[model samples]
Target: MDNSSSSNITSSPTELDLDNLRAIKVLGKGAMGTVFLAHHASTDPSALSPFALKVVDKSLSFAADADRRARWEISVLSRFRLHDPLHPFLPSLLGSSETADILCWAVPYCPGGDLNVLRHRQNDSVFSPAVIRFYLAEIILALEHLHGLGIVYRDLKPENILIQQSGHVTLTDFDLSRSLTPKKTVDPLPVCSDPETDFVPSRTFTRFVCPRKKKSVTNQKGLRKAKSARVSPVSRRNPGSFYERSNSFVGTEEYVSPEVVRGDGHEFSVDWWALGVLCYEMLYGKTPFRGKNRKDTFKRILMMQPEFMGKPNALTDLIGKLLEKDPTRRLGYRRGASEIKEHEFFRGLRWDLLTEVVRPPFLPSKDETELTEEVKKGGIDIREYFDKLKAPSSPLWSPSLDEQRHNVSLTEF
Candidate 1:
């Protein structure tokens, strides 16, 4: 129960000692690793300060990729700590621990769970325009900060957006992100006097704009092969140079941009495209272009348009512009987030006063926090718990069943 905060804003990240942690319950699991609700073992268990610990088991068969992604996520989180004035919506690396068999890191816990869970709690499983606007704005600012640091966040979905104690949102899961240099433009040349005529040419000469190379749909099918042979997902290319494209075929199927699906290479605008899909899902309770299978989904993303349920409005209009098939034509492509901030959908928003809003659309109750506390007191060792579960003889635990039982007696927030 050493309650000392491991988060230091002034220095590089240091590995945390695992002996001080106590696991409460499992939060979630993914291809990368498992997350646990944990707190300082020496601190009072009932104290309201807890953090989420993500642990990657190095003993697993797929440990190499998992370990690489874990380290990448840690690097991304470390960047936020180095900022002079930290961005409010990005997670800070609270601590990290590395052992021969495991790699663990901690971030402040978001008791309200992820946005997907929150949306399911609503009456119709959809958020209203007001709520969507509030959440979208915060996400935009977070992406803006990441883009400024030459990072492209490839994954953008409801499950990655977590709600903090104050009801503000913080984005999570940065392992899929890639660092890219912003596209650079050459300066126009000045006109000079002609050698014989001694006359200056007209100043209105137009510079020829080079068109971006297009990849055929047939060739795009081999994008994965092309990428694997050329560069790794976690590439160490010169990020400070003018190159701005990533050929890595990464990102969730439903939220992947048209450019990504076509293997045309992607830059920062891909996040804006995913933002549109997110906004649509928040309002409609489902993604617009999802299909029966991965191939079908990619086809729909490239060839189909988002169908509107009713008459179009400012919000829908914004979504339409952001989802433009051509990345160059996307709403935020040229000017970045400033173009999105000026959209009519966000008109009259007091961006500066967003954090000061006393009440948000929803807030987690005291009972939920208490439920988390009760689970932690069950006396299960965090590392040993996962190891035991993985044994052939151990009974498989169903988190869904536990969630169902917990929900039975709970009141709606």
Candidate 2:
């Protein structure tokens, strides 16, 4: 019931219906719902523009929770004026609607897919320094806008960063975001456990290498295997203030911050930590601290330092500061995006003229839509898809707010 939409959609600009959409294919599926690449059925069958449609089933066993999250995302998007563009990197809610058993919304289809997909296609499954700089600037501006609106984007993995037709990035999947009132008061007191103490004991803290990298290291003894950091963990004492701290634990496993991992109340600094992880992955082709399992991954996040390959530079230095275990000490911890934008890595970059850049690292052509023969003649009825769910299906997985892992996990698009 909390749904509203913008009429600025480039394709229709009018309230569309399930009847008007021909689902070309499933774009991706997430914890709460599935997204489809759909075009207006009334348009030329091979129209250049098609939007992404997200469909959520509100009749499942977890409908109450699903509906609440779906509505929350809708409300958040309602804040952005899509047509005029409050921030270019952020997405606009093109249109939305819900029925007695189904809830749905539309956003502009991102033809370039997600950052994760794009990263895999690169030469080393990684980006160059210039490319990383360009993308990070846009993503940083997006986070800045969201934080300015008092919204904490709990989820910040590469999968949620989508590339628009214009080659600029737009963040998607807001169901995991939390609305907080920015409290300028002093740092929050830690509860339950000190994240600093969550570090693995020195002797047992085996070298936590990113599973993807083949890089190796050795100590003075010339031993290459099973080496771990003796470096002191960053102090947990936060120097910066924050919005009201949230006790709710939610986020992607690899990107979750030290505070959230330790059950300490968290605030906006969590996003900064994730930005660090994002940068590390962009430069090195892998997340810095991924381990065998979620628990191990989180342990590495709380304990180990990121291993910077090759000679360290401004970019690596920026990543190190951002990945500081102490959220208070992290880059952009207090003053937000300004702290990040001023980093040496972004030097000489015109923050205001990002949109005017004629060539992005990658440009998705208008004909990027690779419609199959089935897609060309294609038809899938959304209403019929949900209507067919009269019988019980598998319960959709939702992340536990208590920080416990369920048997199921699904990402949001």
Candidate topping lDDT: 1
Worst 10 residues of 1 by lDDT: 404-413
- lDDT string for model 2 (186-228, tens) is 3322221223323332211112111222222343234212112
Residue lDDT tens for model 1, 226-329: 43453333333432123468877777778888887777778888899999999999999999998887778879999999999889898999999999997766
**Candidate 2 residue pairs in backbone clash:** none
Give the whole-model CA lDDT for all candidates, comma-separated: 0.73, 0.70
Q: Candidate 2, after superposition: displacement of residue 305 in Å? A: 0.7
Candidate 1: the clashing residue pairs are 1-41, 1-42, 1-43, 16-96
For candidate 2, what is the lDDT? 0.70
